[model samples]
Target: MVLLPFSARNTSETNDWNGSKLKDDSKHYKLLVVGGGAGGLGAASKFARKLPRGSVGIIEPHEDHYYQPGFTLVGGGLMTLRETTRKQEKLIPSGAKWIRNEVVLFTPTQNMVTLDGGEDISYDYMVVAMGAHLRFDKIKGALEALETPGVCSNYSPFHVEKHYREVMNFQGGNAIYTYPNGPIKCAGAPQKACYITDSILRQRGVRENAHMIYATSLDKIFGVENYVKPLEEVAQEKDIDVRTRRNLIEIDTSKNSATFQLLDENGAATEDTEKIEYSLLHIGPPCSAPKALRKSPFADKTGFMDVDDGTLQSKKFPNVFGVGDCMNTPNAKTAASVSSHLKTLDRNLTFAMLGKKPYFKYDGYASCPLVVSKNRVILAEFNSKGPLETTPLNQGKPAYWAFLLKKYFMPALYWNGLIRGYWNGPATIRKFSRLVDSKKRQGVL
Candidate 1:
């Protein structure tokens, strides 16, 4: 059961939030949530129940909400695009008002935000969960390449379905997958696609003719050292050419070719460039914080929302906070991390509402289900300090049960548990499992 703050019941609202239609352009709310993605929905649902009706307002322009983690499954032929999507209206919390518009400008100092439709809304407290924006056009000719026959991407909804189809129809040649130069939401997704493709090709007896390559701008395959060895082993076993320090810069759809800028160990581009022709290509497009947030007063030097990593509160604005990919936290930008953020942000923001400083702190917990094949996965969980496994089993090693957890269980948990704000990640389960393991070791069970 969710704990509600008894002191924050009498919240100010523009109109009766329970009404079906929005009244005016100018509005006010006790709490304003920006972006309707995982983080936004989680925060809104949690606080909507805590505050009075018409007190919480969620500003989101899109008509659909996507289960972003399901994209890899869709690309791997395990799920459909429709299964990953839901109408945005159906997900909004019952008591909260939904403002169907984009935020064009943020005036956090004045506790107000300007919408693209020329309306201004004010709030006493705000949560920035705008998330990340995919920039496929950053690569020259990328847009055109996406339209080409053999090139595809799992990042975009428009091209995600094409990925499995391309893999299915693959006759053989160079099948190249790329990871961009900077931080992406799911850092492991690019290689997930590569591994899935390798599995498919081998199953279809086309592995002999296919030259699989995993090109990445990072110096290593994965950031966490604990999971790197297993991933490297997987690549080696599949005979994949793992190329590091190579950032894709251009794509020529007509020529069926791609150009990459070679980088030094420091990740700075060198003078050298390489071009490779491909029979199939999967691009992991570069991503960053949304435009408004990037240019807002809350952003850090890296164009991501600047927040206190521990408290999830804005360093510049005390009344503001951030969650998800938009925040400049060291943790991997996955939905799992967002779920972890919800609890921390909730405790801290609720304290703020009561005119008190934040007491709860977030330990940078994150998890990435590295899908190595249709039947195997390496569940990589970690924090700022190092590897922090949840289960009693060794998560560093790929396991079939982990794959089943990722493929079958996670989506249901996300839709029914996390989105509705009940899920707070696997911390509770981890604690319980650890207790059981300790009892077993002492012969207590």
Candidate 2:
């Protein structure tokens, strides 16, 4: 198979794509990847080697891929934007075909996907890892607030840089941070941004003027208790006022106020909506899978890819698999979760191709490095069976080591090891750690 240059590929239809320079209007491959994020690119890059050259086709529009987890540190002024990205052409496996375009339609019945340019790419097997995206426009007045000076979010690349600048300029008074109403990519990130801002304010000797407030749509501070117990202590110790079950409804950037809806036990907003004044506002926008997949037979009622929680295979289509943030599984949608799921997904998908029963199991392992301060993090690691701590020590306590791991090593692993499919997750360490077994029985390692 002859390979074309990256510049020759149709990255987008509006941008100089014409059949005049093409050999064929359509193509077929053994494996097709729908997204270029951590999930699709990682799986495609790793599995491409197992197949012949040009057997894998990946649909991605962006030229630069981001290390999303590092955005938290970027917001905290601990890292730069350059540290969180890589050229897309460089990361694509040498053998795989890069279909540099966004998928406009999913036709599972026919085993094909249509690109925005009206060309259909057929595949024997496909990975539907179309990652989630921020819906800032869904929330009333959110887009304007994102463009404003004091309001910022770490959720988007365009706005994350604004966060560090906002924190530096904040003279202080009623600084508010919000966690969105539904399942977010990183549940801990919104609060992490708050803590980092608070730390910066303290370090700059302006803590006396700042009233740090954290409001979230989730009922609890965090999902798991092993870490929640200590996080509550940190909140109280730092005087960061915490309010739960409150979701952002609207923002009044002109007056520096935000409106929130109080969710009842049923998760429906009651008649009352409260508005509060603010100086600095950080927003975690509502997220969902891409629209095309949601309309296809692959997604659930909530616009998430419906897949077997254990196998990571689609319940409806045997040839289809879900990965990354697009999956309907209850696991936290972090890169760490994607790493764990891909390990199982790779094996299960391979088994399906071989017409064998899937033997490997994905136990819903996911980790969120909660950056409580600039140099400390509570590494929240867990599965369906409650807390599955990686080390022997109480992981709830914010440790400088975890922070260092998040700051320095994670990006290297993501770029070098993870996309290569060599690094699945920390599950092996969690299972084999001598400290974990001894500490559980003796209360100390």
Candidate 3:
């Protein structure tokens, strides 16, 4: 659920929350889920129905659930933020108990989690899906500058709408977009912001007056070559300057200047630096696992939960598992990847609960829909082995149909199927589409 506030009446007062307030300020459950975003909701839904009522417990302090992928469209002015959100009470599965608080500590050794307000919870099996936190504080002046007139970001709900406003307010100058270093969700978002900005400027016929530039820490425009070639062509056609190995080190809001620390292909900073003054700046901030997860016994040194890349089960404790952005998997972090993660966890975690070794493996699948134009998208889908083509048509090119699927179809599926633990991503769709294509090619209709 999107973390936000609601009236007291709308919470425990309106309905009977199944979570108990024990005499020892403690609770227990057969299964516990920390964080109520996509992964937590999916996990709770998967197992709760099979077990008795109140068997699953989810700890999340939120009132509204957000369809996060829609944030990009919201920021681009194609959709409204309200359209991406739903009441958390309505979204949490019927059988699962929702604890409206955050976990302060995770104790995998004792199979317990300590929550704020001094409540302790013990579970037979636990799934950590707390995901990561954005740190605008990472780059000096970045967080503080978010309130400044010309600076904005799509990463936070509080600021996503500001991007459209900033772009619309532009009077013709440098419009700069940045991709941060370190791990972050939605790797393609920075460039999406760039493209959205470009779309808005071109729509306003102010493209000639503005310099659309993208500054990224990555060596390439995109990870998969199948989509990168098309993205490069889009960049060339749009006249968007795509600068690689340039990290946004500092944002000087007062002077409307951004500082970039140049890096070599080897990923080290050099003595050379470049500065650009901008009218509107959109930044993708650096991110890491939540503070509690980072400080917990389960987390790796880099602050991600240590889990087997194949099974997604905790390396230290077999009864524990991880999904989504919280795990130290090498896969690209995105909600599209969450479908694959949750699909694997729903199967493997249940087997683990039965005292069986998980035989399932998660392919590092991910998708990124690059909004190259108003009604066009370059859909990229791939796994560890490289591009895993899902659709029958060549998906490397930008198409309005892809954009329509992203803009309309995805949100509906996410709300109706994904949160209900029924959707397992487009892999099946890919296979079925391939089968249909095969029949057509063989004239077996």
Candidate 4:
């Protein structure tokens, strides 16, 4: 196998290969994907099957691939951490070359990327799907508090299982659930774990002793208003206190207390400071694109890849595109969104390679399975404008069918249809359902 070397020094000035002062041959690829996560793998798999074997390469450091959506379930005691991860080698398509190294720098202007191991790779087209970085340490006292009892987070696979343990061991007092201030991958997950804990406590006959509180920076239960009313009702019925515009600032683990700062309507910090004691605390840490991307010139002001909202193409560099949580697209970051991104990126990138106008556009489609209880789920599907329900039945109302779809059907669809690039969300199915509904209404009239 031919090995490439990388250098932090300016590569344009130096010319050496294998200890020889020779000009490095810039290797070109049809497609280069940066991450090994869901979006990257989905895009790579699709492109690999379409492009020739040697035409595609994936730069990923980790050897293990995680089904991150399952982390919420793991925290809820419905799944295990071991079940959420798979060998990265098994997930990458057979034809695509996997470069087991992290990208240190992305030079979008030159169509090149530098790896941490001092290797340089050039591509004709690139997809940035590095995803979001969970910054647990960003919150004051979070890291230290996590080391102590009565504190946990489900955002990472490493810490998800600890959530259940913490919940089960709680004797009595406030059980706090926190949602961070920024965009979080699987937006529904943090609250889902809270609901599960509530259910578990109810089943154990300890619900009366434990006070459940959801402190979120956002004012609404959900971004899409269709599910908001129902979710609010669920919280009310479960006696879960919902506090909006409350941001977690510090944790006094010794005293088992948490500090929160209230924000005004404009999101400015206010004078109000609230402190509460807790027996169990579930934190959803602030998330952003990886630090490497933040430091790169390719990133926007928000430290995310600046991509066109509709086309998924980089604004500064036409040859570069972004998918998943790494891009500054105003869509909920989820595995379901990545499935939509894969289709959009695949078609647009191919069009760019052929020097033709891109034909496809991504409407910011994303799905969030709001697991309200052990046996029910509110399958929230929406696009940029608003809710786009796929099923003909009332999606706002939680149903057993939605629960089954989320637990059993969605995972299978993700593994088979999404990972393979066959799934482009449920747009066509949704359209068909709408057509059928129209026909049924006409007949009734």
TM-score of candidate 2 on Cα atoms, chains taken together: 0.92
Runs off by more than 4 Å, candidate 1:
1-7, 10-26
RMSD of each: 3.4, 6.1, 6.2, 5.5
Clashing pairs for model 2 are none
Candidate 2 lDDT by residue in tens digits, 358-438: 778888888899999999999888876788678877788899998999998999999888876677888788767855687
- TM per candidate comes to 0.95, 0.92, 0.93, 0.92
Model 3: residues with Cα > 4 Å off, grouped in runs = 1-26, 442-445
Across 43-103, the per-residue lDDT of candidate 3 in tens digits comes to: 8888766666676889999898888888899889999999998988897888789999999
- Residue 161's lDDT within candidate 1 is 96
Query: What is the TM-score ranking, best to worst?
Result: 1, 3, 4, 2
- The numbered model that scores best in TM-score is 1
Candidates in order have lDDT scores of: 0.90, 0.84, 0.84, 0.82
- Which window of 10 residues has the lowest lDDT sum in candidate 4? 1-10
For candidate 4, write residues 1-445 as lDDT tens digits: 1111133111333322223332443344557899988888888887776665666788899988887887878888888888777898888887888889999988766677888977888776788989999988778999999888889999877778899898788778999999877777787887898898999998888999999999988887776888899999999989999999888989998899999999889777899989999999999888989988999887889998888898999888887889899999988988988888887887787777666677688978898989998878888988778997788898888788988887778877877777767788888898988999898989952
Summed over model 2, clashes come to 0
Which residue segments of model 4 deviate by more than 4 Å? 1-28
Best by lDDT: 1
Clashes of each: 0, 0, 1, 4
Model 1's alpha-carbon lDDT is 0.90
The candidate, 1 or 3, that scores higher on lDDT is 1
Which pairs of residues have clashing backbones in candidate 4? 5-118, 5-119, 6-118, 6-119
